[model samples]
Each structure stands twice: as structure tokens, then as C-alpha cells.
Target: MNKKGISMILGIIFTISLAGGVKGIKVKAETNNFTVDLSNQYRNVTHVASGSLYGLSDENKPSDDLLMPTKPNVFTQMAPNGGQLPNGEASPTGDALKVAEKAERSGAKINIRFPDMYKDFPYKWISLDDWNSKIDSIVDSTLASKAANIYAYELWNEPNWTWNAKTSGISFNEVWKKTYDRVKAKDSKTKILGPSISLYDEPWLKNFLTYCKENNCLPDIMCWHELGDAKGVIDVQYIEEHVKDYRNLEKSLGINNRQICIDEYGVTTEEAVPGSMIRYFSEFERAGVESACSAFWFRPGRLSNIITEDGNPNGGWWLYKWYGDMSGKMAMTTPVSQTSLNLDGMASVDSSKKTASVLFGGADGDNNILVKGFNSNKFFNNKVHVKVEEAPWYGVDTKLSQAKEVFEGNFNVVDGKINVPVTGMNKSFGYRMTITNKEGYINRYEAEEAVVNHANKFSNEGASNGQYIGQIDYKDSYVEFNVTAKDAGPYNMKIGYANGNSQVSSQKLYVNGDMQADVNYDSTAGWMSSGKSGTKDVQIKLKKGDNKIRFSNSQNGYAELDYIQLSKVAKTFKVRQEAENALINNATVNLSSYGSNDAFVGMINFGDSYVQYNMNVPEGGKYKLEVGYANGESSASTQNLSINGGENKVITFEKTGGWMASVPNMGYRKILNLSVDLKKGDNTIKFSKGNTGYVEQDYIEVTK
Candidate 1:
């Protein structure tokens, strides 16, 4: 059978199995065992690094807020004036630089593909002079712009299929040498990466490297594409072998091992499938590949199928977000089966945070996660807190909420090992297992039962409490809850909400008739869609008796409220003070479309203009002082912060694009966290202009 036929058959089989169909087929359901050694640390977590080819159509197509959560490491885009789409239309690379700037702002790198500038898929060969001129423009523009995160310039893209030696009047090897020399001559610091073949071909790579080595034009980074097959079936089962083979080839050629970057990877079918994508992530991290970008198969600006066309996160995005959330050293993980796309996982241990996380999927059924080598005194005592959550695949178009926690409990750590049994695993979903030493008491309150004023209560199958409070668009609309507390202290209040608005929605959270903070909610798949509820946590202070807590739209907010959870936390101190409520000097309190109480302290450009707040703490030594401010200026703004009238410390607030608006069409606010020392009892915190720049202060959160 042809490759297409085989791929089709494989797709059918995968579809059947993914849908949990087993009629007439005897499938053995057995536990897949995996081991995670906390002591055997290999590398630091790369923040779940991954990206896409031509995934960014423009600067704000998907918005930086949407892309920031995934923590993309590198994105491959067409060079200037390139990027011709499959449809005859062109997405021209003119905006590529702007996109790069935005990506860098979001802490992601960029790779520019020179061949994509041709305006054709196979790339109609323009003359050598034309190519050189384009290369010079790219190098010169890049150098002039000073984009530090522009990782590497891909000399060409998929040369095996796009290049024609006979028509170009020169071998592709010579083309590489010419382009490589041109890039270096213009700006020596910029790195050139190439030989981005369509797929892994040993002979092709070996010959290319040999020619480059002899010609003294070797690429700074080796590059290739791993887009399984034409029918979009993922064939990444042997990616480890491919990496090993490339290393051997590099050794035989007497060349030092260079960093490998799979510039483009994944197929259409596997792009949005979290379970299938795990296979790619496992192999890439296992082989120690520097970076990789998900192939843009269907469309641009959707983050390689992690996002939908409607600008909502699919299930796959959540999986990647979980990966990005990983911090500290990556622990060694071994699966029972690794030769094929069976069950596999990656583990990480953040010793400083006293937490360990494992992300596993690919195959379904029951699985056992055996975590070992934990020092009892280091991470846990005899008992450890465990939470297992799943990021379910609800089709590519369906929006998804954050990963749902399926199980939570305290497990005994016997002999530095905890065997976690995950039962009835679904192949389409990716699961996250978090082990932490901290524990807290949680109290849940249904929003529908709260005293609703001008807001309507409605039934939602997806809501945690089966009912929710909605129509909170009016200024007077609110849902209030009167709950009693055992003690007077700070508690973490988690608000479960659903906001289908295009941008982020906010609600003024009130504690006893005073606005405490602004609760921001990102856009979900849809209003009350199953498993699409979003959550935000804010610390609230309550008295020993009854306390009135309310979510009000008095500040131009709109979001469907599902439920509220109050958890008693230990050793954590967080107090939020709104800027509008602060003692202002020469600053004006203006009504804002965003932020707490729909108001902010603006016009703080003068040296004398300041905002001060009096905070009272039970026992304060050192605390994280977070200033929620917005700077719409061209550059970052600075403010002088002082605790208890101490020495003034200059704090820089990065440009937030706009002061009162979320990122263009998305809803995301920025805040700067700084460490400050405070004494017990009453303390005065102040913010004044230490430097010359416009800054709008929203609120300040002091957390210890």
C-alpha cells in the first residue's frame, strides 16, 4: 500500500481507539506503570517550551495574552515580504518584525525562514542576486531593530523539496554557503540555522554537512522538519532514534555536535490532540533537543491548533500551559513502554517551592505513577498532598477551561515512594499529577444561593454547583454571600466564573461594602460550556463572625458566576489595597474600564504625586509587594516605592500597551512584584514618581 493508504488506515484505527470503541476487538486493559526519580535530576524545566511555524499572522492576531500562557520558546516565521499561504493569498512577512517584538515581550524567541520570502510554497527560484539582496535586507533590518530574542536566521526552509539545483544554476550546497557567508558578513553575531529538510534523511543531512564543513559555511544550529506524513498522521515514534542518528553523523563528519532545532513538527490530526502532542514533547525533551515549533498545517495565528479560530483555548493549549507551569529541575521519568507512542510522561521537582509535578498521557486505560527518591525532610513528612487533574480533548473548535482536578487527597510517602493509581484514563486527554507538601482546609459556597440583586440565576450543566448567577452587566448587579469564619485572618477566595466575552472580563470584589480587588476572568470556550469555567484566586480578610463578600459589576464588569471557594491557608499573607482608596497627593482618581472598582490613580507624572496605603499585618517580616499598574507609554515607567517611610526604591513598571484597556481585543492585566520588608502591625506603603514617565496605579497586593 502507498504511504497515504497506510496513513489513512492508521488514522482510522486511532480514531476508533480514541473514541473508546472496542466492539468485536479484544483489547487488553492493563495498568501502564511509570517511574519518576526525584533525586535524578537531568535539566531544568524549559518552561514547557514549544512553538509554531508561521503561527503568528500579525502582531495582535492571537494577542500576546493568548500566547503568553503557553510559554512558547521559539516561533518560526517567513522572512520579510514572505509567507505566501497555501490559498494563493499572502500573509506577507512585512509584519514579521512587529510580531517578533510582541513575541519577545511575551518571553519567546523567533526564527526567520529566508526561503519563505519567495511567495511560493515550493518557492520559485529567483536569481542569486535576488536571494542575496533579500538576505542583506533581513540581516540589516534585524541588526538595526536590535531584537535580542531573534534567535536564528534559518538560511532556507525544507531545501530538499523547495530547492532545484538544475534550475538555480548552482547546487543547494553552494546556495547555503553563499547565504551563510552573506549573513555573517553583514552582522557576524546573528546565527544562521539550516538544512531544514522536509523530514529526517540521513544521506541528505550527511552530504549537506560535509559540503558545508568543507566550504567553511556550517550552520550555527542544525534544523529540520518532522511533520509526520501528508495525511497528518504523527510518526514521531522514532524521533529519539533520529536524534541519535544525527549525533552519530555529526561525529563521523568530525563536526562538533550543534544544537538541534526541529523548526516545524506535528501533523494536522495530532496538532490539537493533547494526548498525541505529549508523544512529541516527551521525545523532544528526552533527546535534549534545544527547541521545536509546531507545524502550521491548517491555518495561521491559532498557535498551531492549540487555539481555535474564535480565539479560545482548546484542550491542547491547557496541556502546554501545564507544561509551561513546570519550574525547577526536571526529574527522570521512565515509562514501561517507550518504543512506540504508548504511555509516557515528564516529571519535574521544584525543591524551593516544595512541589513536584508529573504530566503524563498518550495511551489510555489505567496507569500507575511510581514516584521515588524523595527525602522525607526535604519535600514531605510522612504524608504528602496529591492532586490529579486532566486536560480533556473536547475537539479542536471547542473552548476549554483550565484542567479539572479529578482527585485530591493526602497520600502516605512509604519509603520515599508514592504509587499513584490513575484509573479509567481517556486516551484523548492529558493528565497532570501534582505532589506538594502544603495542605489547606477548603469551604465551597454555591453562587446561585447567594443573594442576587439585579442578576439572574440560571441552570448550567457545566457549573460546579449545577446553577450560576449571570447577567452581571448592570452597574448595580451583584451576588452577595454572608458566611461565618472561625477566625479573623486571611483566606484564599477562589471565584469560579465563565466569561465568553472576547476580552477579559472583570468584577469588583467587595468585602464588607469596600472594594478589595478586581477579579479578572479570561474568555472561555463559551458561556457556561461544559468544562470551560475559569477561576481566579484572591486573598480576603474576614472577621471571626459573619463576613459579607460580594461580586459586583459596579465597575463595568460582566461574567457568569458559578461558585466561590474559601480555603484557610497557613504561612501565607496577602492583603490587597485599591489605589482609588489610597491617600492621593496631586493624583486624580479616574473611573477606569479595567482594574479594581473600575477606578485607578492616574496623573502621577509629577514628583510630588503619590498614592499611599496603610496596611496592618499580624506578623510581617518580609513580603512580596505587588503593584498593579499600567504604563501605556512607549517605554517602561518607574515609581518610587517606600515601606513605612523607609528609603525610596525605584520600581519599574513595564509598558502595558494601554492603561485602561486589555491587550487590544484580549483581557490580561500586568503587575510587577517586588520584595519589601515590613514590620508587624500597621505599615504605610507609598508610591511616588521617582523617574519621569506616566504611570497609572491600579492596586497593590502585599503577600508573604
Candidate 2:
């Protein structure tokens, strides 16, 4: 075949395969330095629930998956007179307790902050004596509620700046001491956290801690914040370094034992992308910080919310799901460099299940992930399976239609290190890699390798991941698949295609050189949303060994091809019968065998000669019948074929030279396939001579 023909033939050849119905197959290998130790675990992730609870009073918000003991952004601070106290309606502290109760019901830890007795209400300052009265009222009310879920009581918010240092006419130390003494007197059992500073100010924290130590009122949990600037851009490295400095400061002050909580931290202003958030999560885990919220200033439908206004999981929602679903212990995941975003990932392993789940980001090409301490002993020869379901990175619109991309292949593991090769990755897509003890099968072939002649107009993405065939137009333009069937009879052809244009389209199918049928492709959600487009399957018959299948859209139909699959279907067969035994008229029984043990009918030199058969089918159902024949003449011949005396179908017979002739090793007799709906008893089928010319007939085989 010439280049044009070869290209056309190649396009058609790649349209065949075994894809659906196979399970437990691992994907191809990738290279990266993401490794996990199944034996040595650092932190127990199940006990590591953390997140902030901001404006989550209603049930419509997503709060169940985050760590409990969440710090509610609003407690009693928003209510007047601190709203209702346990002492009748005279005081206003019961409103705060009620808010705490709601937080507990929402499966989060109860957290509350005290209001400024003066500024919160009539917008005026109050005397130290008046503050004492309010503090006493709050303590009485809190003691009465007996709400055990209350995790912490923040002394004040942003004491470093939000509270005027020299003015307010009162000192922070004086305010802290009076409230501390009053609350302790009422309920010393409650955990008291202090000086909720807005930023990492060592001088302010040290002064506050030193005074609290002297007065014997040090906070149980030290708290601070890590906020982004006006631009909303947050650097993960900057956050990591600040946290390390905080730890060192704690040790130097002889307060190293105090539990730390950078409760409020965020990388972006209004939008929180999962890739950057996961990096923050890793930093927190490494720094031994307690709980941290995404620092959301607005509610759902806002830029920071994981759930969108339509209630579908937006890009950042899956990250929370993956984090919430993980158990066991945290394994060490070291990237190529601490500053490089290429290998950002967090990994964990469950020894009992022998499964490792790694949530990864920053992948653009082939990378190797080295995993150690897997449960397997000898090499199982199983492939590394990576299932990547990504939502766009918050702002990318195309990623909104993300469908799950799968990559599978075998990998080599020496010693305890299992090196998995992962390829065809787009930057910023969330990847989940799992190493299992169960055996897996490697994918057969890639779609690009089988593509013959795809038009260059359509753009290709995820091509390395076997998802790059597209821009199908016209009937003659197509893709081909050279597929090999281990044992073939009847198979289902599954085609993965996209028609996001919202218009109906179809492609013509050709099996082994004969035009077969047309496969229809309905419009999908979008080109990227393959999950919505789905797979189209059609039943086709294949002979044992290699076969060529082609898909072409000659009618100017519009559709995008992803890949094609062929899965075997169950079939039943009956014995073949000699053609000479059938009823015939102008045809003679040629005893000279044509590769078969039985004799074939020949010498039907005239157009009027016909052969008939009365077949006794054991069951009443649809069955495929194969008639073997040969045409040795220089020119080809056509025969009139009928089933149950139905309308005749003009079947063409290609030239074979002679009944006994074999051009090299190719057989003279070819099988003519046809479908018959037979009754349980007898059915009459016949083959008559046609204007094309004469040919010899061999035995017939029936299968259902």
C-alpha cells in the first residue's frame, strides 16, 4: 500500500481491541521520587482531623468531613448584650452556649470567643468593674450549660493590633488577668487559649506568655495566623519556614510543650485551590500544628467554598474527600526538591489491606514513584494501577468537565523499592496512586499507536494517556486497529467517542476488508467529560487470529474518537455438514476434498443451477451460518444466497483461480457469513447461481 493507502489502512486497523469487562488491571508505570514506607509510620492520620468552622451554622454547608473541634468564626460575639445568660434573661451569655451546641451537632469541635464588653454593644468603652460583671455573667452561663464539646475559649482576637495597645485606656495584661481570674474561679476545668494574635509576632507572644506565666494563667494552646497579602498569592515555602521558626521560638522560651494551633491559615484571598491547600496540609502535618481552617471569609457559592452554588463538588471538594477517606499512618513523601512543585504529594499505607494511597500534584510528564515496604514477597508481576480523577484547579474552566483518566502498566521492583512509571500527566491534575497486593493486567495498546490517518485540524490533549484521537470527518477518513484475538467467535466492539457539539453523528465500520455496519455517537457533556459521553458497543464476529477493523466517517459526520475496545462474547456451535448431501439441481458432488474431510459440490457451470438444504435446528433462535466456497477463475463471481427462502442477497466471491489451487499457502475456499432466525424444527436455506459466474461450495457451520 502507498503512504495514503497505508495511512487509511492504519486508521482502520486501530479501531479494534479488548477493553471493557476486564478488571483489576494496573496502569502504566511513571517516574517520580514519591515513596512510602509501609512498615515505619509517622503520624496517625485518623487522629489528625483539622479545619476551621466558619459560618457553618446551617445544614447546607459542607462540614462533616473536616476535623472536629472546629473554631466557629462567629459565636456570641455577634449577639447583643452577649444575648441571654443562664441567669434568667438578665444576662446575655446563653446565646454563645447555644451557638456552641449547634457546632457540636454539626460534627465539629465547639469553639467560641468573648465579645468586647464595651465596643461590641453601644460602641463605647466600659470600666474594668463593668467588664468584671460581664465576665462573671459569662462564667455563670458557661458553667450552667455543661456543654462538653467546647474545645477552647479564645482570650481575644488579634490582640497585637485589633486591640489598641496604648489606648482603649486599659492594658491587655489587665484585661487578660481579670477575665482569667474570673473564668478560672468559675470553671478551671475548661481549656483556656490565649492571645489569638493575627500574625506571627514573637515579641508580642513572648511578652504575653511571660506575663501569663508570672500570673500563673498561661494558655493551654498557643495560637497565631498565616495570611496572604492583598494579591491573594500564598507561597507554601514561606508558610513552612515561619512554622519552623515558631517551633524553635517555643523551645527557646521553655514553652515548647504547649500545643500549637495556627488555627487560621490560607494561601489565597477568596479562592482556595486544592493543589496549594494540600501543600499547606502537608506543612501542618510536618510542623505538628493542631487545626487550621482554609480561612474562608464567605460562605458556599463564594470563591473559597469546596461546593458550588449548584451544589456540585467544585475543583477543591475532591481534595477534602480524599483527605477525609484516608486512614492508617502518614508515610514520608519527599519531593525532588522542597521548592519544586513537580513532586508535591502526601502518601499513606494500611498494612492490613496492603494498599497505599498517594494524593499527588504538579505532574506534567513521566515520573518515577519509589515505594518501599510493600507486603508482597516475590515479584507478582502485577502492574502499578493509577486512577486519576481530577477537577480543574478552581479557576480553570476546561477542567470543570474532568473525567477520570486511567493509566496502567507493569513495573519492576527490586529489593523493597517498587518503581512505578506514570506518564501522560497534565499539570495540576489530582492523582491517586494505589499499590495493591492483588494481581493486575497491563493495558494492551495505546490509541495513538493505532491511529492511521487522523485529520490535523483537531487539537490533542492527554494523548500520552491513550485519549488523543479526534477530528473525524468524511467516510474515507478513519482510524484502523490491528487486533489479535486469542479465540474468536462473536465479540462486542466498544468505541469511546465524544460529540460535544450536541449534534448526532456516526462512523462506518469495516472488519477485515468488508464494510460492516455504522456505529452511532451521541453528544457528550463536553470533549473533556468522557464520563458523560460513555461507551458505545456493537456486536461483531471475528475469526481466530489477527483481524483489521476500521472506523470512518465518510458522510461528513462530526465526532471525536478516544479509543476502541473488543471484548469476547459467549457462543455455541454445531457440527459442519457436507455440501454434497444437500438437495441440488445442476450441481454435482465433487469428491475431491477442498481442505476439509467431507466432499464439496462443484461443476455448477450455468446460472440456473441451484443448491438447497433442509436444516434441522436443535433450538429456535438467531444463529450465524458460515458457507465455505472457492472461486478459481481469473475474474470474481457473485452468488445469490437466501435463508428460509427469503429475498436473495448478492454475495461477491473474490478470484481464487481454481478449486484446488493455493496461491502460496492462502486457502481457496472462503467463508460467507450470514445470520438466520430458525424455528426449533426444520428450516430451508438455498444458494443459487447468479449472473457473476460459477464457484464451488464446501461445508457449512452453524453457531449461536
Candidate 3:
């Protein structure tokens, strides 16, 4: 765990027959290095139960209620021919592994989970014995194939239902532990991922996770389900769980490189909302969620997301392909999974000593594990695409030979963190980690070298934003610019602060060492009357790396960084998008921070007036727009939008009606545009507002 944060990266590869070691290839050009090692893949969808794919025959039916196929309580189903779900034949497995081998050849890892549907049966009530028996059956059936892809096992289907509820009297905790322990004993190499909390913010999820930890059931990866991740009727309390937050949570738990995956996740695919799935999937990938499964492959005829149907353009299957089919890279596992090794040898460890047998990449339990780039190379530049063969479990799609590439993205620098993808590639596969550029410009700054700032200075990241660098201290005349521009240098500059009513001082700027030139601090006109009429200017030159400018408040009193301008600056376009309700972080947005009365808050880039948010205007003008519920007065007592600096302008809201929009300007984009009066210099806008109830900000749109 050095400053780089990359430690303990291992590979999971099966030791096949004779030729089993590693195979490798190189691109020859890149410097960062491209390495691909083997890690567990097909760990999710490999469980194959016999005879279900071809359909059961007449003699296999179990005498029961065949009439209720979809009911949650009815487990026994009499087949059309009196057959049980898997009544007919018993076989080891198929050539799917060969396809996996081919996929590996083309730059991807592959595997399949057989006996697709595990918890399709119904059970309203049952004892712990029954649950154990059912789990035993699943494990036995899955192992029957002797296939490595069927290595790890998921707990019974959605437990909230009748069958799972009745079958497992205890919570998923008790059930998963038993299953995990059994699996680990059976195969030490095969890691287990679990307790898939149905959603990120489930009310009862904390208990399940605690159970796992308390019982030493920490999973190799975490799994869970989330339905209609977008449309909010699902009752998820904290809906804005971003990938970074989730990954950070894992890190906080002290699991160095362990992954967090969404075992089951579905985005509303109804064209009703374009990019719904795209945006949803991106959040996890961009945020570094290890893996995500679309809500389900539920009988195509029964639901909207189906991989097989005809005619639809962006159907569920297409999404799978879109998410899966990244050229030679539809498998975004750990970099270990990508390190190609070129070796032609044989090595095997017999399990006769009651040892564990682990399997990874290879064609027919015979190919060697391939690893590439042993040097200090990480081809982190290459985008990752993951493709998981679906299974019969809850409508998961399983096609290894023709696996579709999903999520062809990679990790980029974001706020200085090289955030990478963790999962949610093709649904229902092993966890994946493809570096992405989306995490743009990582920030690993120490406290001394870092200071996070909203445009308006000294204000919380809320609606009540204050003035741009309003010099807090007036007596000490040393000004410090907001660290917006990169690589600001060293120079003598004047800063303003206050000791009683009037005081300020300046200091020579030094980045790493050399002091900057021309230190100037005047007390006569510019120093005494700061922010009154206008402010004075301070200049400095910064080197490439980190530059520090110090301002000393001799008395340690309240000092305001009233105004600061970079002597040498670049052109970075500023565009802010806000919500009518409380939409904080764009990717990790949440709507539960408001009280009953405070349901809305918003932000805007006066410059980009064309792009509206929260309240819209009939005709765009410079009129201020606010978001919040108000009865029939000019201004309701509970104002959704609050301004600092003593209300820069009076925004008379249309007290009544359903949520009205206010247009201060006479016309649309003309004067109403937030950028109506852009002063030549720096502009900082802050936001602050809240109430009793939480806010729900969908978005606010603006146009010319």
C-alpha cells in the first residue's frame, strides 16, 4: 500500500493437463506496459444443471402444481410431460470451455455458469434443514459438470420471495456463510462473492454485511441486486451510491484490492428515457463498480429486457453486446486477467490430499494460463470491455462463443485519482477492473498542497454561496488566489485580511524554493477600502509542479480571501449543471438531504444560460431562477433558493400554481442567460438552500 496504492495483485488460472503454464504477446510500442495475467472468470455463470437446456421429457415431472409457473410459493411444478425442472439426463458439461479458449485467444477471458436458473422454485415456508438440502443439491448438481467455470456459487435466488424465505428460515447471512464455507473447503482457489444487498441503500443491508464480517465471511467480491436503478418508485433510501463511494467503502473496510460488484442490476430500457441504461451503467463503471448484471433475462415474453427477441434495435441482448463487445477486451477483470503469459508446460496439484483445485483460463482444462508483461508495465491506457456469459439464474444471458462486449471504457484521472472500473461489464460475470479515462485528473494532494474550493469563496457547497474570494481579513493585505489555475508560481503579492476592523499583509511567493518578484502591499487606498469600490491586484509566477503562496495573518483573526486572480492563467471553459431539487454530485447524486419543506436546490452557470435547470422560462431573460415549493405569496416562507451578499437581486416567485418559473429578463437567452454580464475577470457563483424534507432534483433544462 505505497503511495501508488497498487498491491497484492494475483491471478486465478486453472492448471490444465500437459501444456499448462502461460502464453504471452506484446504490442511493442507502449511504455506504461501491457500485462495480462489470469484471474477467476466465469466464476459466476459456470454452474450448469443437467438436462434443462434441451427441456425435460415426460418421465421427469414431479407431481405438483405445474399450473403456477411464476408464483413465488409454488415450488413443485408438474411438467407438460410430468417432468421435474431437471428430470432427464446427467452429464459432466459441454464444449463451452472451448469457446472460452477461443475468446481468450482473441484477447478476452471466458467461462459459463450451467444450470442457469437456481432459485426459480417457490417456497413460502420451510425449515433450515430444507434450505441446506436445497443448497446441497445445487452444489452437487453444479459440481457434477466438473467444470471450473461453475467454481463459485450464488446463494438461492432473490430471498425476499416466498420460496427463498420459506426455504432459508434465517437471513441471507446464515445461509450464505454455510454456502461460502462449504465452497471454500471444496476449492480454496475459488473465491466467493456475496450477500448481494438487493440495492445499495437497503434498509436491512447493514445487518447482512455485518453478518458476513462477524462470521469471517468476507467475500472475494460483493454482489447485490438493484431494480429500475433510475425510476425511483423502488423504495431505495440512499439512491445515489456512486462507484467511487462504493469502492472507497471497500477500501475503508481495509480490503486492499478486493472488489465490489452489483450481481444484479437493471436500468429501465424503455425508450421512455434515452441513455437511462447508458448513464446508469456508466456511473458504476466510471465510479469503479466491479461488476453489474442487468435486472434480469426474465422470460422475454414476460418482461422488457430480453436478449433473444426480434425487431428491437437497442434490445436487452443488444445492450449486452454493446456492453460486452469491446475488441479483444470484453473482459475487464483485474490487470492480472490481462497479463498474457507465453509458456508451453504442464503442472498439476492433485486434490487427493483433500486440497483445493482452482481453475482460470485455458481451452479444455488443458491450455496453459497466459500472462503478459512481467516488467513495470500496466497498459492501463487500453480501455477495458467485459463480456459475461449469462446463466439461467434470473434471466441471465449465457453465450460464451458469441459473447457480446459491454462497457468498453477505461480509467482516467479524476481529481487526481486514477479511478478504474471494478464491475458491471457484461452482467453476471467475474468482477472486472479496466482503467478508464473517465476518472479524469486524479488529485492525491496532501493538506498543505491541496484546498478544495467552490467558485464562490468561504461558502459551503450549497445554495447560500458567498462572494468570489471576499477577503475575510481586511487588516493584513496579503491576497491568495483560489487554486483554480494549474501551476501558479512564486511572486511578491498583496493579500487582505482584518485584525479588529482593518488589517492585511503580503508575502513573497515561493513554489518549491526561489522567491517570486515584486512584493507589494499598500495601506492607503487599496488596503483600507477592500471590496468597497474595487480590489487591488497581486501577481506571481509558478513553476510546473506544486507552487505555494503564503499569506500570514499576524493576529490569527478572521481573514477573507476577498479576491485572487492568477497572474498567468489558461482558458478553461466553465459549465455548471444543477437541479431544481437537491442534486449534489453529478455522478453520485442524492435526493434525500432535504426535509419536507426543503425539497429543492439548484446551481447554474450564468454563462451557459441556454442550458436550463430546475425552473424553466417562457422566454429566456436574465431573470433569476429558483427551485422550491411556495404557496400563493410573492415569496413563500420556505424558499428553495437562497442568495448571499444580502440578496443580490429580488427574485419575486409566482407564489402559487404547481412549481412556477420566474423570468427576470424580458427575453429568453438574450438577457436571461446566466452569463448576461460577464465581467472581464473571475466569476464565482455559490449555492445554498435546504428544508425539512429531502430534495429530488431530476434536472433543469435551458434553451435559447
- For every candidate in turn, the CA RMSD to the true structure comes to 20.8, 25.8, 21.8
Model 2 Cα lDDT, one tens digit per residue, 1-704: 00011111111111222232111111222234555555556777742324453434333343443322222222212222353122112333323465555556644454455653343421343566776777677667767788766667666666766665455687888788878877888888877776777667777777887788788888887777766533434455455666677677777777747776665666322234555566666666656666665553333212134554444454555665676656677876766557655566677766656566777665554454556654442323233343334534422111233435354433334455554434444444456666665534433333444656744323223222324466666445777877777676777665655555544456777888778756665444355223222345566777888888877875734666655556566555474565766888888875331223224678777766877877766589998888778888789887787878899888788877556323121235666777778787567777888777777876677776
Stretches of model 3 off by over 4 angstroms after superposition: 1-125, 160-169, 229-240, 251-257, 267-274, 297-704
Give the per-residue lDDT of model 3 (tens digit) for 1-704. 00111122112211111111111111011011112322211222211100011111122121112111211110111111111232112422122332222222222222222113332234233565655555455445445545443223444434443234334456556766876777667556655655544455443444565566678877776655555433424321122354445555655555545565554444322211111233333334323444444442222111123221221222223333333322221111221211221111111111122111111111111111122221222332232221122111111111123322222212222222222111111111212222322332221111112232321233211100112233433334443322323454333222322111222223343333444432222221221122111122334455655454544333333333322323332232232234332324332222211111111332221222211232322233343322332232334322233222233332223334222122111100111123232223222232323332122232222232
The lDDT per prediction is 0.73, 0.56, 0.29
Global lDDT of model 1:
0.73
Reference-based lDDT, residue 101, model 3 = 25
- If the candidates were sorted by their TM-score against the true structure, best first, what order would they fall in? 1, 2, 3
The true-structure Cα RMSD of candidate 1 reads 20.8
Residue 183 CA displacement from its true place in model 2, Å? 2.1
Candidate 1: misplaced stretches above 4 Å? 1-28, 86-94, 229-233, 440-704
Clashes of 2: 45
Q: What TM-score would every model get versus the actual structure?
A: 0.59, 0.52, 0.32
Q: How many steric clashes between backbone atoms does each model show?
A: 1, 45, 165
lDDT of 1 at 677: 85
Of candidates 2 and 1, the better by TM-score:
1
